[model samples]
Target: MSELSVTTRSGPNGPVVEVAGELDHDTASEVRALLSGLELRPGTQLVVDLTALTFCDSSGITVLLAARNHVLAAQAGMALSGVPDRVQRVFRILGLDQVFVTYPTVEDAVAAWPQQTE
Candidate 1:
């Protein structure tokens, strides 16, 4: 299995975690564990920058949902940024694209994030 990696970058709003490599059952657990410690305050946007994600399975999708729930519970916004077409197809098929705010890029998401707060 290819190793999964995560990198984080922060802005005035909040942290955007960049996920790379294969995200399957085994590696998904690491993501979940990391997300468990996230502090998504009210109005902060937690953007999952999925630009480099090579692969993602059902377990990965579940972790994404969990992340969404965590941010929503804290009244913060959650967004998927730079999602590959493959992943977008999955979200579209599942009708999750309608529920989750998706952007072409992190900048686009961040630009819209402040609007959601207001």
Candidate 2:
């Protein structure tokens, strides 16, 4: 299993979390903790960039849902991008596709976020 790593950067809309490696039972909690520490503002869009994500299991899926719930509770938006075909398939089979907004790339996801007016 690949070692899980998460990198973050600021985007125009909000923070972009770049997740790489396997997000399994062991690493799901780490991801959850990282997400929990974020300071999300209302209307901001939190983009999870999965371009380098190697694998994800049920535990990872649960963490993803929890992240979504967190963002929603803060009145923010959330999106996932660069999902691997295998991971995307799992989401489709579980009908989570309907729950999460997905994009082809992080750029596309970030671009789609609602622009904030000063």
TM-scores for all predictions = 0.93, 0.93
Question: Candidate 1, residues 1-118: lDDT per residue as tens digits?
Answer: 7679998788668988989988889799899878767987898989888989999999999999998888889988888898989999999999988878888888888888678652
| Error in Å for residue 19 of model 1 | 0.1
Clashes of each: 0, 0
TM-score of candidate 2 versus the correct structure, residues matched by position: 0.93
Displacement of the residue 22 alpha carbon in candidate 2, Å:
0.5
Q: Candidate 1, TM-score vs. the true structure? A: 0.93
Predicted structure 2: lDDT:
0.89
Task: Say what the RMSD of model 1 is.
Answer: 1.5
Q: Write the per-residue lDDT of candidate 2 for residues 16-61, one digit (tens) a residue.
A: 9999999999899999999988999998999999999998998899
**Top of the candidates by lDDT:** 2
